[model samples]
Target chain A: MSKAGPPKSHPLFVRITHWINALAMILMIGSGWRIYNASPLFDFTFPREITLGGWLGGALQWHFAAMWLLVINGLVYLIYGLVTGHLRASLLPLSPRTVWADTVAALRLKLDHTTGRYNAVQKLLYLGVLALGVLVVLSGLAVWKPVQLWWLAALMGGYEGARLVHFFCMSGIVAFVIVHLALVFLVPATFLPMITGRAPAPKTNEANE
Target chain B: MKRDKSLIAATLKDIAPDLKRIERRLFLRQSLSLGALTMLSGCDLGSGNAVQGALDAMSKWNDGVQAALFSQTRLAKTYAPSDITPNFPFNAFYTEAEAPVINGKTYKLQLSGKITDKKPWSIADLRTLPQESQITRLICVEGWSAIGHWGGVPLHVFLDRIGADKTAKYVGFKCADKYYSSIDMPTALHPQTILALDYADEPLPTPLGYPLRIRIPTKLGFKNPKFITEIFVTNDYPGGYWEDQGYNWFSGS
Candidate 1:
C-alpha cells in the first residue's frame, strides 16, 4: 500500500450512506432483542432490566420504524451503486485470474495482507450480507402481515417458518458484523475509506519498481 | 358531562395552564430525572395511587379510545385455511395433568378464580354452552405464528353461567399446569375471541391445551392460556406471567 491516509476509495455520498446503514443496523439489532425478549424465541434478550428507559414496546416501535428506514436507505444505496459505476469496482468480484491469485496471496498471509480495496473474500461477504438483508425484509413482511402477505408466508412455509428465517437472518447479520469489526481492526487501512472516504491509492508504478 | 365541542375546548383552555404547570413540575422536570434514575436502578418510575392510578386509568382509557376510535381500522384480517402452516408448534402450559369432571357425571372441570363462582367445570358442562370454531393464526410476540382451527365455548357464555358481575373487568385464567393469565373482559367478550376447548376438529391434545385453553385471536400466542382450570373475574388487569415482565398487554395483531 502507499502510505496510510492518502486519498482514493469512497465517494462522500457513499460514505454517508454506509455509516447511516451501519448505525441503523446497530439500532435495529438492539431494539430487536428487546422485542424478542417479550417471549424470547431462543434465550437472548437486550439488557432491559439494567438499562434506563428500557421499554420493550418502545424498542419494538423503534425497530419497526428503523426497519423502514434501513429498507428505504439500502434501496437508495443499491440504486445509486447500480446507476453509478460503483457496483463493478466495489461490489462485484475482481477479474477471474485475480481471484485464485488473491486467494493464494490472502491464504499465505493468513488474511493479514491487504490486496486492493476489497479482496475476493470481502466481495463474497458483501454479496451474502446484501442477500440476507433482502431475506430479512421479506421475512419481516411475512410477520408484519401474516394475512396480507399470505403468499410470502406460504413461501416461507408459514408465519412460524418466516419467523425462523427472520431470526436466522438476524443472527447472520450479527455474525457478519462481529467478523467485520474484527477484520476492521485487523486491517485498519480497510476502515479508513469508511471513516475518511479515502484509501491509500496504490502507486501506479510501485509494483513494477 | 355536557358534551359540546366549544365548551370542551374552553374547559381545556381554562385548565391548560394548571395542567402545564403540573406536567412541567412533576412529569417533565422532576419526574424525568427521577424516571431515568428509577429505570437505571430497575424500578418503576412512579408509584402509589396518584401515579399508578393515573397509569391504570390511562391504560383503560387507551383501550377504550382504541376500541372506539379505531373501529374502522381492523387490526388484521382473517384468512383461509390454506394459509395455515403444516407444522405448528405447541407452546407454554402444554398439557393437562388431572382430568376434571364436567356436568353431573362426576366429570370435573375445576374453576380457580378469586371470584364468587369458585367451582371446577366438568367437560360436559363446558360443552353444554354454544361452541364456536375458527381457523386463525396464533401470533407469538417472539416473532412466530401458527395457524390452526380452534374450537371452544364462548367465554361470555360461561361467564354468564357463573354470574360474572358488572364489577368484573378482567378475567383470570389458571391452567391445570399452574399457568395463569388475566385478560380484560372487553377482550374476553370479543365475538371473535374464545376460550378454546378443542383443536383441529377434535378434543385438544394433551400436548396442546387438553381440557381447555384460551384462544385469543387478537393477542399473541403466549397470552392464550393452555390447559385452563380456574377462571376468575376481577376488577384489575392482573396480567399474564410474561406480561408482568414487561410485555404488551393488548398484543393486538
Candidate 2:
C-alpha cells in the first residue's frame, strides 16, 4: 500500500508445494488413466500415450509411488495454508452472489487479476478444487483399502462407487489445471510471481499490456 | 517390450462395455505434454528397468504400510444376490480357452510345509469338510468387481485340520494353471477366506477353477488364486507370480 503498487504475492510454501503438487498430480493422473484404461468405467477410454505407466503393472507401481507425494504434500500445503491464514486471505469469502458476478465478468473478459487479490471466480475454483482434493485422497483411500476403511468406503457409496468418485475428482483437478494454465498464460505477468514470489508493480505511467 | 498405442485405446473401449452400471460412469484426465515430459524424465520408454526397480522398492514399502495398517477381523461386505454382477467375470493371465484341463479323477491337492498331516486330499474330501457359503464381491485390481456365492470349507478349517504350525508366516498355493500365489498367514486364516470348491452351490466351473480355488474376500481378486493344486505353510517368504512382477505382495484392497 505504501509503495502504491501491486502487492508481493505467493508465499514460498505455496510456490514450492504448488510445483511439487503439479508434478505429483501429473504422474498420478497419468498412471491413473492407464489403470482406468485397463477396465474403464464406460465405453470411452483415454488415449494411452497420454497415460503414465508403460503397462498395467508399471502404471500401478507409479500410481502407488506417486500417491505418497500427493497425499503428504497436499496435507502439508493445506496445513501451511491454514496456519499462515493465506487460505483465508486469498481463497476465502466465496459466496453465490460474488461467484455469480465474477463468473459473468470473467465470461465477458472484464474480470481483473492485476488487483493482487483473487477474484471471486478464482477463489471459488481454488477452494472448490481444494475441497475436491481432499475428496480425491479420501476416495482414493476408500478404493485402496475398502475393508480397512469401510466407513470411508460407505461414505463414497462403496468400493465401486468410490472408484467412480475418485475418477471424477481427478477430472475436476484436470479441468482446474486447464483453466489455471490458460489464465496464467494469458496474463504472463502473474506467472512469474509463482516462481519468484512476487511480480513487479504495474508502472503507473505505462499502458497495461 | 514395445507397445501399440492404438491397441491400448481399443482394449479400453472393449472393456468399457462390460462396466457394471449407470451410476458407474467414466471420465478423462490430463498429463504432461508427451515430448517435454519424455525429455525431462529420461525414463526409458523401453525396458525402463531402473525405474522399474525404484517402483518395485516402492511397492515393497507400500506392502509394509498396508500390512501394518491391515485389520485382521474385518469382513468385506456381503452383497444380496440381486446385487451380484450379471456375469461374474472370468479373469486370468490367459483367456478361458487356455484354462488347463486338470484330470479331476486323479487330482489330489498336495500339502507340505510345517503341517502334521501331509497326505494329499482329493477334491471330494475337500467338498465333505464343514461347508459354508456367502455371496461376496471379488474386487479385482483392474477396477471392476463381481459377486458370486462361493461355498467350501473355510481356509482356517483346512489349515487347522492339517495342523499347520500356528505361528508360521505364510500360506502358499501352487495352481493347476501356471499362475501361483500366496497369502500372509493371518489372511490365510480369515473367517471369510475359504478353500472354495463350489460356486453357486454347484461344483466349481472350469473357468472359475474347477477343482478348487482360494477365496479371500478381504483381498483383491489376484490374491485369490484359482485352480489350486497344492497348499503349503511356510515361515519362509513365498513370492507370488504377480508379486514377483512388481505388484504388492500383500495386495489387500
Candidate 3:
C-alpha cells in the first residue's frame, strides 16, 4: 500500500531448488492420489480417475517415478543446505528480541513492510515444510519396505498406521499448498523474490545503489 | 525510493501468474502425452475384458521385471517347518462371536448380487466342488506375520458354479458376525487363493473360521474373512470395517 521498504532477493540456487521442490512435490501428490484412488478412502474418491499410463498399474509407475524425484531433490537440498551456511541462517529464530519482534511483525502483516530475507513466520513455515518432507519420506519407507524396516513400522505403531501417517502427511502438504498459494497472492512481492531473486531494496544507504 | 517500491511490486506481481501459466501449460502437455499413451494402450475402468487384458499384459511385464530383478536370487526358500511359528494365533474377524451369522442348522452360503444365478448352497455343496490347499505365510498389514497350512475350495470353481458376471467388480463376503469384506474378482480367483474350510490340516478352529474362511495369499490378513456366511458379487466397492477406517482396501503384498 505504501513505499514501506526497498528490495532484497533470494540467492539463485535457493530459488532454483525452491522451484524444483515445488514441481516434484506437485507430481508426487498427483500420482500419490492416483495410487490412493486405486482403493478410494472413505466415501471420498478422486474427482476423476487418472489412468496415467492405465489405472492402478499406471498410478504405481507414476508414484514410484515421482518418489525418486522427491527423494533426490530433497537430498540435494539438504546436502546443499548443510555444506553452505544457508541452513544455519534459515533455521535460527534465536534471540527473544528478533523472535518476538518478527512474530509481532508477521502477525501485524508488517513482514511484507519490513526489509529482510525472511520474516519469522516465513522461517517457521519453511522449517515446518522441511520437517514434514523428512517425515513423509520416513513414513513412506515404512510402507515401501514394511518387512525390512519393521522397526520403523513399530515406531509408527504399525504398517497400517504408517500408511495412514503417510496419507495424512501428504494431505497436510496439500493443505499447506493451499495456504501457501493464498499467501503468495496476498503478498505477491514475496513470490517474486523466489522467482527473480530480487525485491525492493531497503531505504538503508547500502541498498541505495 | 517510491518508484522502486511500485517497480519491485509490479515486477513481483508478474512472477506468480507467469509461473502458474507455465506450470499449467506444462501439465496440459504432459496430460496430453499421457492421454495419447493410454489411447495407444486402450486403458479404461470396469471394462472387464479390457481390464483383464491389461492385467495380463501387466503380469507379463511384471514377470519379466521380477525375473530380471529376483529370479536369479532364489526360486523359493526351503524352511524346516520348525522355522515357522508353531502356535500361529488366529487373527479373528471383528471378534470371536461377532462374525456374520449364517444359519447354524442350515449353514448355507448364498451366491447373489452380480451373478447370473442366485442360489443358496450348504457347506456340503462347497465340499462337493473342487478342493485345494496351500501352506503359506499370512502377512498382516499390522506388521506381524504367521505361516499356516490352509485347505479349502478354489474360488473359480465356486464362481463358475454360481456364474459370475464379467462386470462384477467385487466379491462381497458377508460373515456370520456382520463382518464383511469385498475383494476384487481377479484377486479372489487367483490360483493360490482359496476359501479354506480347514487350517493346519484339521477342521478350522471356531476362532479361526471353523467350517469356512477365505485364504487370500497375495494380500494382507484382514481380507481373509472367517466364519463364512454369504458370498455375493457387486460392481460397487463394499469396504470392510478396517478399510472403512483408513487401511488400503486392496492391500496386496
Task: Name the candidate that leads on DockQ.
Answer: 2
Task: Give the TM-score of each candidate.
Answer: 0.53, 0.88, 0.49
Which tens-of-lDDT digit does each residue in A1-209 have in candidate 1?
24555555677778888887885776577667656765677766656542211354445544654665688888988888888867777767556676677678777864433334577767777778989988998998777656445678779977778878988999999899999898767655566667776654455323322
Candidate 3, lDDT over the whole model: 0.64
Task: Give the per-residue lDDT digits (tens) of candidate 2, residues A42-102.
Answer: 8999886788765666678779998998899999999998998888878778899999998
Best by lDDT: 2
DockQ of predicted model 1:
0.07
Indicate which candidate wins on TM-score: 2
lDDT of 1 by residue, B1-253 (tens): 2225334555554454354345323322332432433332245544322443333344445445434432212334465878767766755421122333232345365554544586777888788889988888778765656778888887777777777763567888776566677777667776666778788778877656776788877666777887676677777667876555434465554
Could you give the CAPRI-style class of model 3?
Answer: incorrect
Top-down DockQ ranking: 2, 1, 3
- The C-alpha lDDT values of all candidates are 0.64, 0.81, 0.64
Compose the digit string of candidate 2's lDDT tens values, residues B142-166. 8898889999999999899989997
Give stretches of model 3 more than 4 Å off: A1-8, A49-54, A94-104, A113-116, A200-209, B1-30, B33-253
What DockQ does each prediction reach against the true complex? 0.07, 0.39, 0.03
Mark the 10 consecutive residues where model 3 chain A has the least summed lDDT. Answer: A48-57
Q: Candidate 1 at residue B141, lDDT? A: 67
